[model samples]
Target: MSPKKRFEFAFPDIGEGLAEGKVLELKVQPGQRVKQGQTLAIVETDKVVADIPSPRDGTLVSFGVKEGEIIEVGRTLAVLELEEPDSGGGEAGMEEERSLVGNLETATSAELPPSREGREAAPAGPPVTAGTTAPGLGQPVAASPVARKLAARQGIDLAAVHGTGPGGRVLRKDIAETAENGRPPAAGRVQPLSTLRRALASNMERSNAIPSAVIHELVPVEELVALRRALNEGRGGEGQVPRLSYLPFFLKFAGLALREYPLLNAAYHPQRQEVEQFGEVNLGVAVDTEEGLAVPVIRRADGLSLPQLQAEVDRLAAAARGRTLRLEELRGGTFTLTNYGAFAGLYARPLILPPQVAILGLGRIHEQPVARGGAWAAVPHLPLSLVFDHRVLDGVYAARFLRRFMDLAARPQELLLL
Candidate 1:
């Protein structure tokens, strides 16, 4: 053996405050040839499942960490022998130019070309640079380990599923949606909780430590509905203008209400046994993704207009699902909003995320019989659930906050002006 020379790629800071990640998969073995930017493994952090790509064209020597092993930042992931060995520049010099966490691009939907085997082919524009889908090319079908596992259990080949993720990457949602359409759910199966799921469970457990109270109310939203419809009509184009919905209205109303009742938008300092009220409103919007729930924050939401807020919400939601959200987008949320009503729920006693004293859940908007002009008439009503930390806010204060929110929600057009 001509002097053993190799390059070791260490895990870098994949996300803000992410100290480590669990190795969920390994895409190459010893002696296997991997192209630069090809996926080498799948790593799962608390926030999302991210693909780890090879830093250079090389032959894999060995992986430092095994599957399901938690590796901390700055730890070597793998060693590889470069195809073109440097004569003067040593391994240290070559490693300095490589990005360990690079090539992890977001998946975007593209028109699938004619199938080679009656299945949707990869994008037609050009060959994928990050991860390959063709056999003998590189890794086959870039997807999260969870997505691949689910596809295997369903007897569905990943290539057949349409990928809407960045660079035509297949996602867990794509697999789950395909499985639901092709085969019914099996009686049951035992699978380990993902990092995202485990993190959510732990957070929920922590939330239970806080004594919370939930207050339910029904707000008339006929005016809100009409306002939204009219606003959308003027600027209604798919993926163009921000789609107006009752959500933007609710968010605006909540922010305005928070200004008056600052207590509702505060974090509790348990160590000091006091409430810490924030000067700015950083609202967390709970988004459901294939991995799990991610709350991306809208920084200083109070300063944003209805249109601006709508666009930010849309961008954050897309980023959350695509696993492309940054660290700052995931933190510093003074308050939270979860819309269970979007799934046809009447109301849900939403849990208060620890430290944050309150969380508001929006129930389904539906037509119900309400007294109008002293007569029972069918009108659209919105169900609102306000859950607050009892230590920080009394029931009366919580009720008052809701009343202020409803006062703004009832006059939806007025909010549009703001």
Candidate 2:
């Protein structure tokens, strides 16, 4: 018998620290011929549902994980048998090159590499720097640069002109307005927000309108950090050594606390005129992406172990950044968490997603002086912000939930019990 050649496919980092995900559906079966970048399966992460694509073109042998099963980041998702595995390898090379573009720009900037005599080296190219005002400065701008130039040739000022572009940015309509008025004033053009920006704007507006009362507390995270380091050391593989994050610990504690204080996990139902408490804890992990903010839910979080949680996070994050997430992956979140601390923010008042009564905001870890055995010492601490629906939960309940979470986070060992 001829020996079978085996090639392994591991999950790639899509972005947003998604560690693991639940396999929702498989598009290809074993022994099937598949092309590179072909959709293989649909995996749902905490923030979104993404289609897992084939890493290479080959004949599928078998799946490393099964449908409805959870998968970790960097774990083999599938195996393939290839006739010529290295064929069309240039595409992968291009992807690697694109990834380094940002670093190249940073390293090649004029400030980084000064010109001869250091006369503030000229720009690399055209005047594309943000906030540059060389154009239309000291001139009555009547429309877009092109429109303004056209109007100027015909002696038109855009100031007295009415705008037709969205948000009243000077457009062809403004020139028509100038002609109707027999005069044009200096008008300038404005750029409209992109689709992603518009989506974010709407979400922010909706979040602001929800009646929310925020409760804040401080949690000593010294033990949590220690646990993460221990896990990393014990795993001992390139990707097997999990990237330690405070999120898994937080999710564990939140799950236990939810059982004790169901009000935190309950959603307010306006149509039914009742409070609906969920039997399962589907926690949403907020992932910020180039497209916008996405929250993928980890279903039945209360039932998963710490290792399981970590793996799922890894997979989900990778899928999110890849933009292969599916629509179904974003549904059914009972509670939401926004870890703003990852970006160095002290704390943020995250708006609560509707129906879900509460949302948790995690802030940066800060070092503060503490008295240890009568001696002053510095300790790392995390700030916790909980915003809840004031109508459903009172201050006392909210405070108790925050206190429990803080206590559990301070002593992370207790979380393993639940």
Candidate 3:
């Protein structure tokens, strides 16, 4: 029998350009015997909350990261002690790695040397916590656990203080001195962006790269409003039929318009100089939640009946707000629709998401005075903002799409209802 080896499970690249995830929970602790495929920890990534599972059966030795710490891709997450077979077993059945999201790469005692001090060796590289960066350096700072705890308890950023201990590791005295020195107020200190904020910044930066154009229009929706109210009043109790919102009506209308003007429901591959258009309108509806803006896609938006559309919209909105939406629900959107009217915005200059050529923004519906048959009448008009990528289509094409959408919205009765 071979000596027991230590297995190091590093964080995996779970696709969708995930850089890091914040550990929401630790499911296992040292000395706990875990079976293969057991969940080790739960983490919050850019898109969803995920579980980091054990790749192979072993005894949990130590964790490279603690709960509430952020683990970057390629950094070790946990260490496990394993008994290896002498022959016919490839790296003690721990060579390959797998996770709930995707494949992962792991290292073991075969590649890494074990600690000579009679304890499990920690995974390579430091866990990149919230404030592990050095003052002027981008790398993680070397500090004792005691100092780290004291600094955190005192609300002192380790990166802003100079170390005085051996090997320049920040000590307890350094933290005490920094707190006693009275650093600048929180308003003036450097505030590192959270994981969600970082993802939003990256997306916004990419959005700014597209050559976008926005055109606004006001469409009368008195008839649509009356229809929605009647439908809502006639609906059954909870779990039978969902309450209707104007956004669902617009979602259906937008699908029809996208079918008529397929160019608007297309993706532009700039590197390949190609435009990929889809027959189905996979509409992405933007839902604002406490975490941030989440766009959940409704597959085949053009085919659903009014009730189905409303129910789906309600379900997706609820899931997004609760942060329980599946990965597939947040992907493969050919076009996006965002309703900012809930916030009382009349018209907004919404930005276009990358790859998708167009996005439709809906604004608050309000009464506008109009002249009808030599008489002044008030009509409810819904504001619309259509933003599109110039590289995929021009202003005229986008305007025509919006016109077709408004034509559908003009008569909501034409759409089939359950």
Q: Lowest-lDDT window of 10 residues in candidate 3?
A: 109-118
| Candidate 1: clashing pairs of residues | 106-166, 107-165, 107-166, 108-165, 108-166, 108-167, 341-363, 341-364
TM-score of 3: 0.74
lDDT minimum window of 10 residues, candidate 1: 109-118
Per-residue C-alpha lDDT of model 2 across residues 1-418, encoded as one tens digit per residue? 4434556676544334345665644567688999976777766454444566665678999888765456776676887886653434466744553344323223332211111111232223223134322224343332333344446566665555554432233555566657776774445555344323544566678678777899887877888888878877757466565665678878888988888899888889867868999898999998876446877788888788877888777777665555445444566788888898989787678999877889999999888788999999878899988999887899899989889888898998886565
Query: What does candidate 3's lDDT look like per residue over 64-107, in tens digits?
Result: 88655688987788888877653455564545432321345233
Q: Where does model 3 exceed 4 Å of error?
A: 2-6, 66-68, 84-190, 236-240, 416-418
The models' CA-based lDDT, in order, is: 0.76, 0.68, 0.75
User: After superposition, which runs of candidate 1 have C-alpha atoms over 4 Å from their true positions?
Assistant: 1-20, 25-42, 51-64, 72-143, 149-189, 238-240, 416-418
TM-scores across all candidates?
0.68, 0.55, 0.74
Best by TM-score: 3
lDDT for position 364 in model 2: 92
**Of the pair 1 and 3, which is ahead by lDDT?**
1
Write candidate 1's Cα lDDT for 257-335 as tens digits. 8999999999998899988999999999999986678999998888888888888999999988777776668889999
lDDT, residue 13, model 3: 63
